[model samples]
Target chain A: MLELTKEPFFGFSLCMFSYIIGIKINQKTKSALANPMIIAAIIIIAVLAVFKIPLENFMIGADFVAMFLAPATAALAVSMYRQFDVIKKNWLPIVVGCVVGAVSAVVSIVVLCKFLNMPQDITASLVPKSITTAIASKLSEQLGGIVPITLAAVLVTGIFGAISSPYLIKLFKIDNPIASGLAIGASCHALGTSKAIEIGEIEGTLSGIAVGLCGLVTVFIAIFL
Target chain B: MKLFKKTLILFVVCFISDIIAYFLPFPFPGSVLAMIITFLLLLSGLVKVRQIEPVSDFLVKNMAFVFLPSTVSIVSYLDVFQSILWQFLLICIVTTFITFVCTAYSVKLTVYLINKRKEKTENA
Candidate 1:
């Protein structure tokens, strides 16, 4: 059984199998917290721990899966282009909103982390927490952060935005769909955008646009940070 | 064959972006450079939507699956997470709300100001 772990096929198949199960569980539970990535990661980690399989062995095949990261990040252009018209019309508010959102996210994380005496590395990871995973992970790598922690921070931020946006909207008296959607995407990325889509078509579309724009803004901001 | 062609195009673009990133002074990400290039290509009518659609859609939809291994790597650093779990959770909650509220209001204010200027100009 331990020998099987050496084969790249073993790791690849295990990853696919676990993720499919994760998706199935998500479908059954219908809970926002039942994120397929979280479920799949837990399952894979548990299996490796139980079997005493070295992470290095698992990584041999996992590298193949990670190859898609670059292409997928680039493919974000397709969706961004689709929102070009809305962005053109509301470029002022969108640009201002994303810049504000990205700055606040980084500033708040740094301030809070410093106040709590969290280490510098963890603070770096949390700086990119509000963006999508692909861009966030890369930014984390660039900032000398631990990628896994960055992933964890991004996942939590996204879930929080998805769950709290509606209540936050009411609390703040935010009436415009565009404003609401931009806020959600800037704070939560795609996860919150899913909820925004449920709220309204315009909200969803604008939220989607915010994800890409906010990511771009944060990338430039990170260079200075 | 078509899927292969589209995937190849994306990979080729990624390859070019990687080269471009290598020549830059700053530690820019090649993947992001690829994103910008792809966006420009699409916007300028150099790359049609349908050309990249099928493969791009698959990659985006199943994106989480691709990152599972990276997430699994967290198992190696369990100690870091265990020590900072509470602080981490607090930061996430606090910062998410702060960013959300700030973005929402700034956008609202900008729109309001734009409309006010529009009204003033109309009267003039």
Candidate 2:
């Protein structure tokens, strides 16, 4: 069994299987919280726990899935490129919004941490919560925060942003696709970008740009602050 | 040949940015440097936006899969989190709420400003 687990394909298969099941669960539940990733994680964890399988054994398979992050993040450039015209025309507002959103995200986390008297490490982890996980993880590690905590924070932030954005936009009567997409992407990252795509082509493109810019701006702020 | 050259340039830009980021003493990861470099390249028209589409699209599509490694790491740190689960939960919930509120308010404000400016210009 251990020997079987060591095969690279084993982990890849498990990850893919889990992801597929997660998607199915999401479709069945029709709830954002039932996200395929989250559902898959729970299923994988439960199975591992029940079978008394060590995490190390399971990770041998899961790492295969993680390797795709680089390519996926690179793919966002397509959306950015597609929206170049809109980006060029409203460069000033978008830049200002991203900067403000990124700074506010960090500042609010710090303020809350101070008020709650949370541990410094936790505070550090929370600082990069609004950025994408790839960037946030590195920032967390450098700041001496827990990477897992930051990952979890990023996941939750994205989910929240994705789910609530539509309602928020409706309530605020925000008609501009650029504004809508920027708000969601800056607050939630890729997850929000997914929902932004569903909202409309323009919103989707703008959201993609926001994700990249938010990640960039948050990185600088995370380092300095 | 031109397409290949442009692709090569894109890869070189990304690679060089990564290298520069590695040498930086900043606390954040090096990918941010790559992004900044990419943005600069785009801004300067040294690399047209169209050229980087293939690479960026690849990155965006598989974005969620990247978190699996870290999620797996959760198993190793189960003990640490178990002890501080409540704290972690609180931080996650509150920070998320704060982010949403701040982002929404900022968007609203910006929209208001744009509208005001438009009105003033029209009246003038």
Candidate 3:
């Protein structure tokens, strides 16, 4: 087993396999609720368990893909730059909407935790739930929150925002792309931004900008509250 | 010459901001600093938007793949997570629903308020 693990290519193959299988399952499901990542995670876990492959060993390969997070997040600036005109015109409303969205998310989570009498660590993990997983996980750890729980929260938030945002926009008659994007990005972070991109270029750009802005805002808010 | 100068400035801004953030004793990570620095440079007209485009685009396009490492880490800590699995699931579902409802409502309210204000101004 150790020798098999030492095979340098094994980890890479498994990561690729997980992503491919996950994408395939996602395409076949066509259900908003059925996230490819969640499905892929389950599949990967099952395979690992059956093969008795240690999670640590699998991580050796997976980490390579994860290292791209910094660059990927930085890339959001492109979309943000493209939408600078829209941002310049409606800066006030955009900023206000994001603040409202961020505050609402954080407050709702804290209130829910209090109502449920959840443990402190869990509550802390959830405080940064509106951010992307990479940032949220670090925030959770720093705040002494449960990192796993935070990751799950970020995933669910992103997927939920992605699926429901369109319906909500239509229902509310949100004509402005900037507003729509801000709402999605503020609440769901990166996952929501991906969905925003699918909606249109304007929506994508605004959401990308909002994700970064909201992350920064949430970090400041987290410190005070 | 112009493009090289712009890229150099952007890199310097990013690096300096990150370094400053590291020593700030702040709770937030250094990336936030880099973002602020970049935003300020753009807003101040010190750094050309076109110059930062390449680096920024690279970051956003592959954002999903970035979370792979941590998700894998989650797999290793399954036993720890198992104990709180139900709690975690509940939190995700509930919080997500709450965020959606709040965000939708807020957007609706903002639109309504803005429209009303416009109407009042027009009438007056």
Correct interface contacts retained, every candidate: 0.86, 0.41, 0.35
Distance from true location, Cα of B14 in model 1, Å: 1.2
Pairs of residues at least 3 apart in sequence or in different chains that clash in candidate 1: none
Highest-TM-score candidate: 1
- lDDT tens digits, residues B4-47, model 3? 66455555655675578667775765555556666666777876
TM-score of chain B of 3: 0.78
* Weakest lDDT window of 10 consecutive positions for candidate 3 chain A: A69-78
Runs in model 1 deviating more than 4 A are none
Interface RMSD computed for candidate 3 is what?
A: 3.2
Q: Which candidate do you rate higher for DockQ, 2 or 3?
A: 2
Q: List DockQ for all candidates.
A: 0.88, 0.40, 0.36
RMSD of 1: 1.1
Best by DockQ: 1
B9-61 per-residue lDDT for model 2 (tens digits): 55565567667767777654555555556666676787776675655654555
* Model 3 lDDT, residue A62, Cα: 72
Weakest 10 consecutive residues of candidate 1 chain B by summed lDDT: B24-33
